[model samples]
Target: QLEPLPALTPEFLCVLNDVCVKCYTDFAPDELEVSVREHILQDLEGFVRRQFSGARLRLFGSSKNGFGFRQSDLDICMVLDGQDTMDDIDCITIIESLARLLKKHPDLKNILPITTAKVPIVKFYHVRTGLEGDISLYNTLALHNTHLLATYGAFDNRVKILCYVMKVFAKVCDIGDASRGSLSSYAYTLMVLFFLQQRNPPVIPVLQEIYDAQKKPEVLVDGWNVYFYDDLKTLPSRWSEYGGNTESVGELWLGLLRFYTEDFDFREHVICIRQRARLTTFNKQWTSKYIVIEDPFDLNHNLGAGLSRKMTNFIMKAFINGRTVFGTPIKVLSPIYPNQVE
Candidate 1:
């Protein structure tokens, strides 16, 4: 039998809260940057309209999900009506054409169409705003994933704060970029959500379970069920039984680090928050990986599939260090060095 963990005191909670609030404010994108990014999206939408009529371009990822940082890259997904499968469509030709069209715009630079990539995308740089973005065709699953994250962010303020703090920590430690064989910001957000959901007195309810109870309409995207309770109005009634936890944002943050470092069994269990139940690595057949973060919409997609063993060790070391730092009292001053004595 395991003993209950020690409770955080009010004084320590206040200190952690202050640190979280400051970190969130410092990392969040400014109003000007948000407006500029929106304008760029609109301009791109117009460009897409001129060529591919009846097509829609929408924003996804951190920029639209409320987890974006000051310098986060924008992820756009293009959905064109009457297109069913990639087999019927020549994505490379379409991407190449879009690249040529975007090149005409003086404000858009470094337009590169990477057709052979797993998730083919056309990357570009916005000269005017100094921001980067990528456009992928028919990545509708990402849109639903974005909405899910947004709903989670709105469900609890602490979710967003802790997520932002962790994202910043990942950046500072240089292990946040998935393209470089490390975890993505989205994966980090999922890790935080999983920790919160699995807490002793869970901070939030399992959203998918709530949705299932309501018998809400089903949404199937690319053969995967993408349904979830997204209405904030009805959420109160659903989560009334769970009530609210008195844990501070700081306590939750520290708990997140400690949970990942000390408690979680990465080898045996999957980091899944879509359901209230625990999923095994054996069930998912993801045993060979260091971490398994399932994409809610795309069941086959593992967000942590790209993470290498070396990178996993680096991330674990960082988490352990973070847990030690945040889980204990901080030293306000450093000892004086004898070599620097005047």
Candidate 2:
């Protein structure tokens, strides 16, 4: 008979000591990529601080989440403290300075990184490495006067509540428990409205108008009405056309919900799910089904005139998202994976 080994006695001091060391050593790196990140963050802070004193720079995105691999680029946001107007000129200057500094670093330069932004706002990306860093000029005046602050303006009770809600919903939607996808259970819950809008007699007026126009020439359609996924159905691999879907439903839900929830909500909306009977090279030959939803309340009424698609999407998301696990969110990132805590 095999002898049984004594059970391990819990060593409270050892555990506490290990925890303290881990806390301190969390960011410490013995590898090149890690060292590079630490060096870059330190350097960027020093440079920016010298130019704009009292400015607080924060690290977020993948870097802050502790999920980034060594190759992940650093994402930084600089909030200028005190009285100062943020203008395009100021943004340009900041970008220029950082671009010049980034070029000086050998690792950065081999990548031939460049600084550029879409404008009105400034964003930077390294050309070679595809690493990106974002900067936000948080003016106290703007925070009080505009909606820019509404999205991610400052730390406030509203923001705290919004974040909490998003985190909770994201957790629930991650595993197949709610749905096998990465959209926020709440957001997916909301997106279902979009699929519903696509259904005949689009639930949303905006979608209705779009559908009507496509159905009959007399129906009115405006250019101001822009839809990101309208042409998606035409793509060879419709779902593949929108690369964002690459994220497991859980990741996509968490990221998008965190990004968009404060400004958007779908209390009353619908979605549809259907399968195309025909297939093309770009399109999947399979008569695979698609879940569709629509938002009747869409102030614009733009999805399209008809609710031609089925409502499989609504049934799945609603039924799955509604299941409560001890009042916590559930997720199934993959079809085969078990539901996990969010």
Candidate 3:
């Protein structure tokens, strides 16, 4: 189905390695940047508590998921201290009120409440930081999603590097913007994790599949099993295939493009990371879409569900081009210095 490339030279492979590493070095936020995000969360939480007492705020999405880019929006989930869940009507009302309250803040502007969204949120621009932010009520699953990504990212340095490379790749290919008829960065991250899981030596173990006892322990949030083996300290003892994969990030990055373009049958299989098995599109009854991606926690949510046929073709073609481009190596240039990555 695809053209195979000749063996790549070590020099070219090193170039690929440096390029992938550059993605992490250039884009991943520093400690102070991450701390600033937390400070903003705390400040917003305190301010929201003035009107909605017991309001607790948390930073989710890329801010907390070890994925950093200059323009990454702050996804903050807010919940009351004693409240377990929020209904639709109350969520809308609170979002509207939150927008009005945020308007009074000195350091914020362009406050907008989008109650029509699946997850009702009050959006605001933090003028001081020059960052866009959103506060959603009862967005429990997104918090769990951030935790899962963070766990995978911290488990292995290669995982983090590969994820950054994938994000950079998608951004370069212009297929990472969901609002512009393409998949989101989160969806692309899921693809990287899935590709890593499906790698021959398995770069990382499936956290949701690992268990301690006779049965997988159940931890439910929003009626979905959010259980995953997060104890990295004893992960080696628990997961049998620990420390097996030792591939360079460059190889994995190229392999990811090849996996999606040459090996994976997007029409037949779904990209699922929760388990170490082939989940078919038919099993999920999502054969309508070519690029089916299942959310780890939300069984019903297909990240690729919103993609139009034209956009799907464009995404697939980008992978095809990526496979050919990465597979056939070329002359090496001087590697980018760490200091100049910015």
TM-score of each: 0.91, 0.30, 0.96
> Candidate 2: RMSD over Cα atoms?
18.5
Best by TM-score: 3
Task: List ranges where model 1 is wrong by over 4 Å.
Answer: 1-10, 82-85, 212-217, 331-342
Candidate 2 runs further than 4 Å off:
1-39, 50-55, 65-72, 110-132, 139-342
Ranking of all candidate structures by their lDDT, best first: 3, 1, 2
Q: Report model 2's TM-score to 2 decimal places.
A: 0.30
For every candidate in turn, the CA RMSD to the true structure comes to 4.2, 18.5, 2.9
TM-score of 3: 0.96
RMSD over all Cα atoms, model 1: 4.2
Worst 10 residues of 1 by lDDT: 333-342
Q: Once model 2 is optimally superposed onto the true structure by TM-score, how far is the C-alpha of residue 231 displaced, in angstroms? A: 43
Model 2 lDDT tens row, 315-341 = 334334432221233343554332565
Tell me the tens digit of each residue's lDDT in model 1 across 1-342: 223345555655666678887778888889988887888889889887888887778889998899998788989988787875564257778888989888887788999999888778999998877889999987878888899899999888888998998898899899898889899888999998888889888888778777544375577877888888888878878786455676888988988887887788999999998887889889999999978998876878888888878999998888887776666554333332112211
Give per-candidate clash totals: 0, 67, 0
**Tens digit of lDDT per residue, candidate 3, span 1-342?**
678877988866787888889889988888888888899888888888899898889889999888767668999999999899989999999899899999998889999999897888888999988999899988999999999999999999998998888888899999999979899999999999999999999999899998888899999999999999999899988878888888899888888888888789898999999999999999999999999999999999999999999999999889988888877866543444322211
